[model samples]
Target chain A: MAGITIESITKSFAGVTAVDNVSLTIEDGEFMVLLGPSGCGKTTLLRLIAGFDLPDSGRIAIGDRDVTDSPPGRRDIAMVFQSYALFPHLRVSDNIAFGLRMHHVGKDEVTSRVREAAELMGIEALLNRYPTQLSGGQRQRVAVARALVMRPSVILMDEPLSNLDALLRLQMRAELKHLLQDIKTTTVYVTHDQVEALSMGDRTAVMRDGAVLQCASPMEVYDRPGDIFVATFIGNPPMNIVRAVARDSVVKVEGVEVALPEASNLPAGTEVSIGIRAENIEVHTEALDGALPATVAVIEPLGSHLLLTLAVGAESIKASVRTDFAVKRGDPLWLELRQGSVRLLGSANQSGPSD
Target chain B: MSAAIRRPRRRATPQRQLAYAAAGLITAFMLFPLYLIAVAALQPRTAVFDYPRALYPSPFSIESMAFFLNATGILPALGRSLVIGVMTVVLALALGCPAGYAVARYRFAGRDLVQLLIVSVRAFPILILAIPLAVTFINWNLYDSVLSVALVHTVMALPLTILLAASVFLRVPSELEEAAMSMGTSRFGAVWRIVLPLSRQGLGAAALFAFVLSWNEVFAAAVLTVRNPTLPAQIVGALGQSPLPFRFAGGLALTLPALVFIFFMRPYLFSAFGQARS
Candidate 1:
């Protein structure tokens, strides 16, 4: 319902910068996910946007109104905290109506709005129960219902699905997608799970070390990472990187030749690192043209597929192959790296991993 | 892993046996004097002076009780004590609960110093407080009144109540208050609607403590008031001239109200003390 703009925001606690000069624009009615590893400042950024935290220096505007110093109550935004934060003393109906009551809405309007939100969350039967009596998922629904009852223009969620089991997380993911689509409120969700980000976000912003590395559609972030940090943090079974140096049409990895993409415009003899996703590497019976010969260091069966940890010279890389493959530790294998998927990183900027 | 299913076989060791024995001895030691007072209170006046105090009084009579209940000035003393206790509880709760909330919620400068002051207030002997209060009361023409006694008792009870209640309120999740604020409630409204309801058990316990402190206090009561003395001050005032039955009966009368209140509020006491410690 409303767009949020954050400009040059930074937050520090006891001289330790938790969120650096981060700026982002969230479109109206968009479902955005801030995806990062733990302690990457995604949650901090969300809290700043929701007005739970004050930025050391920044301007925050919601729907063209500068809300930098406004208290959370005046921001017209709702947040579902990680702990669900349901008022244990209040019944589910009262919890949903709390925002309304604070604004002095009449009893009849409170009840009607509470009922509408409860029905929207399919928690109509649970209105009379206290938070302690509800299951984790039920309490979470109540938290969501409480946030939604106010019809806030923006709803911020901090790892709302982290406490659920795998199956429940999947179910909630689909439910949340449908729910947000129907309400169309500008929602900003934060999570450490790549799967959740990819599945839920209209656009996913990958962050690390107090900065947003990249913000794009999930597929774009995966396929065209802005930097080395986004390249490694956005995909499952993480992308594998091996140090290499380019020289006259060939890239050398530990004195062995590796192919380069023709479209890659890096200068010749540039010291770089080559990145490849596990799924992009194909296994073959024998060494073929442009394929690297490697030995299987380990094989992990994942019911549907086998994860082969392959030893390419001194470095190891993982490849997802069919579980039916007759592969074992110490077995010789041929790995074909998908040419288009190879990401080359310049060596001069080598530092620590972003996340 | 199946071995985990087996129940542990605990043998009685000398150390464990000694610990149980010590606990039983301590409990009996604490209750024995109260039991003796109860026996003396129920006996006839003649039975009280008979040497070798009665472990149990036979044909218990309420005559001493009726005597105290009907005595010209005794009823007024009892009324004064009740008034003082109620006033002390109310005043202490009003001032201390909010002070406690401030100490627990804010991190302003000198907060630790304030906390240290409250802790030290509990340790200062009440006798020291009585000396200064006596001079202040006499100078102000406030001597021998329930108001003077209630003010002194509040001084005695305020620190303890605030410390305990503040700890109780601190256990309440700040996240809940934040949630309320984000839901459009101001800071004051959040505390009023959410924090206060959750902390009622603690506040009640603090009130009960304030009442008991005022109800049983004697030194300050004696120092501050005479003709309008509280029950404890009256008991102490009549000590030399009083008979055994009268002494025991007065003690029983003074303690019974609080004992009954405690019994009625027993369920909340555990949660209150637990919250304080946690």
Candidate 2:
């Protein structure tokens, strides 16, 4: 278990930067996930930390050792690849023992470690079978077992659960979280799925266009995004940002005047945006004070809950409502933004207001 | 269930029947020469040359095979051919596997040029290269030796062996090698332990091709070597004066060993070729 620090790391291919000037510190034994859309450099960042790729310019250190230029084998890291890359010719036992054999571990130690890792992965019955004989889920288990048997200080996984079916993916996700927690190994997991990062990461780094937008606890990223990109990318339905003007302690959203908190500071007629999440939008049938009149455009019943998509003036927003609320489409509705729910975002060049 | 089976029969239009018949006829046409050779090899000496070439041998016996096997210096030539074939395969594999790997894995300065050269070598005839090498062999005092024949055969086999093995190596996802490296195996160790084992069937197919190519090559052996001639060269040389029975029996003997090898490798061959397609 070791902490890994990446400072100003950049990687480029044919003049196109794959990972550009990224910096992050993963504390000892933290499950840090790099989450982004596909081709957003999350995997590249993981590979850079694993020493599978060398940064064009920067330094990476694991524990106290500088590993920027070291080969992956010398970096003391193990990786479970996305494809599960098990050796087809070797049985599960040999696959698990591959690293041990390469490091010249004695026969008895290799056997014990292989058996132990296989048992940990719940694949002891499959020790003698080849990878081709295993199903997708079993192959994933074997891949994880192979990586675990190495006992590396840091374990890096690149979308390891992407190949499994949906139900299997969820089961394996829980299994991976439980296993990592028990072992307390420092792990860096990369995936394009925000849900995976939100559910599994001790801290999640949201990335876009080869740079990290925010790295924080899932709640911090959800409740307090640093920029419009994070505000838009981190949430499931995402935060809604509408054009508005903030001036003289008052914000006008479209044609409606919204009262700002006393002591709120803003210049007169300042152009800004107001951001709100779906859960913060309160729906009412009759027009009331501090509420905007709207029409419910669509209602989606999600078994235990309902999502009412409403159109107010020319702007549309979604509100999470209860399932038995008896709301239908094409109904007149008035929704009010909860107290302090509206977050004012400054102009494009200016940073968004901190939560 | 009976109607379901009969539906396909009712749907078999005239065009479909003609297509099926054509395929069957073509297959039969391709197999006829092999059938004729086997029949001739089994006939008695007098029956081998009988008019209208017997579709089935009358009084079929192993007499011709016995004669061919017991001929003066024939068995020695066959042994020499086997040795040369095996040696050629070993050399091609040793030289080609790493070169193929380098081509597949690395991005050296002249990588594209090197790959192009290997591919272009196939377009030219091997006989064109063999003739010059034969002269050089005589000058170097390697003429009429197994080494000379095997060396020339290696050149003939290297390009295809390298290309095929390189394609095979490419099919083995590089992620496996990378995963091995991540597990603390050096690059070479990863390839040696992982990639090589995974590509065994491909290597076997490459080796089989090299062996068959060297085993059946007559031009290089005929031109470069004399006393230690391969079986093909011996049979060709014997044909100049030997009777019909000798030619048929010798040709049959030469073809049988390669057939045995192909049969043994039939499953792997089909799989390797299928991988090549995919």
Best by TM-score: 1
Instruction: Give the alpha carbon lDDT tens digit for every residue of A1-355 in model 2.
Output: 7999999999997788999999999999999999888878999999899887889999999999999999999888999999998888788898899889888999999999999999999999999987877899999999999988988889999999999999999999999999999999899999977788888999999888799989999888877776777777777677877766777767887677776544347777777767778898888888888787888898888787798888887888888888879877789988888877676655535543232
lDDT of 1 at A18: 84
Q: What lDDT would candidate 1 get against the real structure?
A: 0.85
lDDT per residue (tens digit) for residues B1-278 in model 1: 00112335778899979999999999899878888888888888788777788788776889888777776688988889899999999999888988999999987889999989987986878888888888888899888878899998898899988987798789789889989999898888888888888887788888888998899898888888867888888888888897778888887898789898888766456567673321
Interface RMSD of each: 6.3, 6.3
Error of 2 at A2 (Å): 0.7
Off by more than 4 A, model 2? A248-250, A259-267, A346-355, B1-24, B275-278
Worst 10 residues of 1 chain A by lDDT: A346-355
lDDT for B20 (candidate 2): 90
Give per-residue lDDT, candidate 2, residue B165: 85
Q: How big is the positional error of residue B173 in model 2, measured in Å on the Cα after superposition?
A: 1.3
Off by over 4 Å in 1: A247-250, A254-265, A352-355, B1-25, B138-141, B275-278
